[model samples]
Target: MPSKIDPRRSGRSGGLRWPLVWNVAWRDLLSTLRDRRTLVSTILLPLLILPLFTLGMPLLLGRLIGGQAAERQKVGVVGTLPAELRRSLTRDESGRAGVELVSVTDPVEAVQSGEVEAALRAVTPLPTRAGEGSGQLELYAKLGNLKGQTGAQGKVESSVQAYNRALTLSRLEALGLDETALSPVTLRPVDASPAQEQRAGALAFLIPLMMLSFLLNGGMATALDSTAGEKERGTLESLLVSPVSRGEVVAGKLLATTLTSLATGVFSVLGFLAAGLAAAGLRGRSDVDAEMMQAMGGQLTLTPATLGAMVLIVLTVALLLSALLIALSIYARSYKEAQTYVTPLTFLIVFPAVALQFADFLTIGDALYALPVFGSMVAILDLVKGQITPLHTLLASGANLLGAGVLAWLAWRSFGREEVIFRN
Candidate 1:
């Protein structure tokens, strides 16, 4: 059994030594585990709250948004379609499909005031502007949510096209022109599975990104709470006075943060898989059901290399952020004050990550595969799409790990300085 030495005794036994690091780390970990708030935040929250908030919540919201956009659409009709023709149009067949015509107005105001989910304007005449050739029925949707706008537009356009086809045939017969003369070429669109198209629809992208970001975010909270939070609570000072080298202290704290981060990532991923499985079983024969459930039926899995890379990246990021946060936290007087320090650090960690969210999946290329968070996004997108290139994966993982190393070194150096650690 290891004996605890009192720091008060400055005899050789009281000198800072290797064992203090374990002592501090063990105490911190145990104390943290016992904390209701800490347990909830570190373990339970990721397992429970993240799935509900990030995955389930977003899915529900998407449905509501899609539903709301489909109901009571205000439409502006222009040109020679005629009011009688418009009145003859019955929405009974389409209304249940979520297309309710509210009112007609200027396209711009309808979109600006949110009076309509979209506006249908006649295309402006020109040598033709960029999208003008899309023809007389123009759709103006707020903020360019192309999916909803395009779906709604398709319904309206299909109705109009059918009406036009009927009228054209009547006119051709009355004018003694062959109906065949109106045809230039036969047209048919091949309807294929959305899966075959590799349609990385909104939810696919959102789920993974949400998982990665929240795992890191929640991990950050754990890191800060474990280290800096201890410092704020005055518990760290007690440990620092004991026998431990600064390096061991850093190593142990790094281990704790890495574990916390990995836990968060794993729990979040499990939640995603669980929800996905349930959704698949619930959807039963719906075309939107993910092919992953069938292809990898009765089992959810990640490739070993992919899982390794993800773990490495999350660990590196968590350690780097924790170190930086701890260094910053040392400057504060209390836990509350440390929170203020962490607020900006949180922003720093989160803001750079936003670039990942907006990156174009269709346009991803090598250069972006080298950019920091952008690189992670590209790598992850590739992973989910089942097309991860080992070369790109290594390069991105290397860059992120290398960057994290530099940040961790800086933080370690800061922690070593007594002036920094005890800054008033």
Candidate 2:
């Protein structure tokens, strides 16, 4: 009898292995193309939604800022002040321009009507020590909205300061003191560094989060379809029957998924940049320069090294997410179950991404720097803040990549297990 051909040992060498990987990858890509609904949902959703959000956000913000600047702010004044003192309070002479001082019978009403950005309730002078007749006047306005309410507060503060100065001058005239009494203190505010100034923009935070969101969203869908969809449709079993190594199968699926995710991320970023630039350009009255946006985007480019780092970051995250989702989806009983499992993952990321935007406190301690998603967030923030120190970037990237690698390995291990691969 002729020796039986061992199919398992057939072509187990190097030449055919790569081709197998490519074939697997190609088949998955083609299958993806055939699913027009998924294709449209993944590709077109980001293409349309990202630009819409980016363009609309700036316009909304500009309207809010401009409306704030144009509003007639109400201010309350207390104490038995002469008409001259009140007139001086709201006039340009006192440097209190662009304010309308309304004498309020009720500070609550002023605030409630939104007539006042904030209300200033003045209290009587505090009792002074033995010889002093009176203490300085006390005033209060809303504190929470300090940035928005500052201009309105400044008007009130200046008016009080001016009145105090006039009172001092009257006393000096009565007692023969000089103007030198008013020169006690001065304040100087230094400007921030050029890098800090340059980094200030909506894009600083929005860009990175948008990049992350697109990656996760794209990766999740690809992972689910490749794993659960295949299992549910009984195609995965056929693929497993081929003379392909499990590693090659995984490698091919992972590569395709990462590419799909990366492409989505890139398109989203470009759309964001384009929509922002176009919106800025369309605003003829905006302080942002058209040429400046063009130059900033073109000349101050993310270098190839930085771009590579960013791509690596995105791909690593995508691969890990794809792998993890695939493992989960394999265990999921149905497509609806897989979708239900992944819904929380979407919201799970959203809060952290939003927190990353609002969180200003930074310890820079080693432990905080070592945390998983938070580290990525901190690194991206540092990158945006123009403080992408080489050591920090390397460390953060190393940690994230290491974690992703571990998770990917675990996913691959899960894929090889019959119990996981064929779970009900």
For residues 75-113, could you state the per-residue lDDT of candidate 2 as single tens digits?
665454455556655566421255676667667666657
| Candidate whose TM-score is highest | 2
Across 1-424, the per-residue lDDT of candidate 1 in tens digits comes to 2223333332223334446556655655665566667556556765776446534554555555445434544455444343423543335353224354555656677666766655555564311222223344566665456554444555565556655666667667777886689787888977453341133334344544555555555545555665557666666656565556555666566666556666666776676556545645533452222333233222223568767766665555555555555566656656677677767654553564465456553577776667655577567655655566777777776766776677566665655665555553
Clashing pairs in 2: none
Model 1 Cα displacement at 218 (Å)?
2.8
- The segments of candidate 1 whose C-alpha lies over 4 angstroms from its true place after superposition are 1-23, 48-88, 94-161, 172-199, 203-209, 282-301, 349-353, 361-374
lDDT (Cα, 0-100) at 372 in candidate 1: 56
Top-lDDT structure, candidate number: 2
Q: Give the count of colliding residue pairs in each prediction.
A: 3, 0
Model 1 worst lDDT window (10 residues): 125-134
**TM-scores for every candidate against the unseen true structure:** 0.67, 0.69
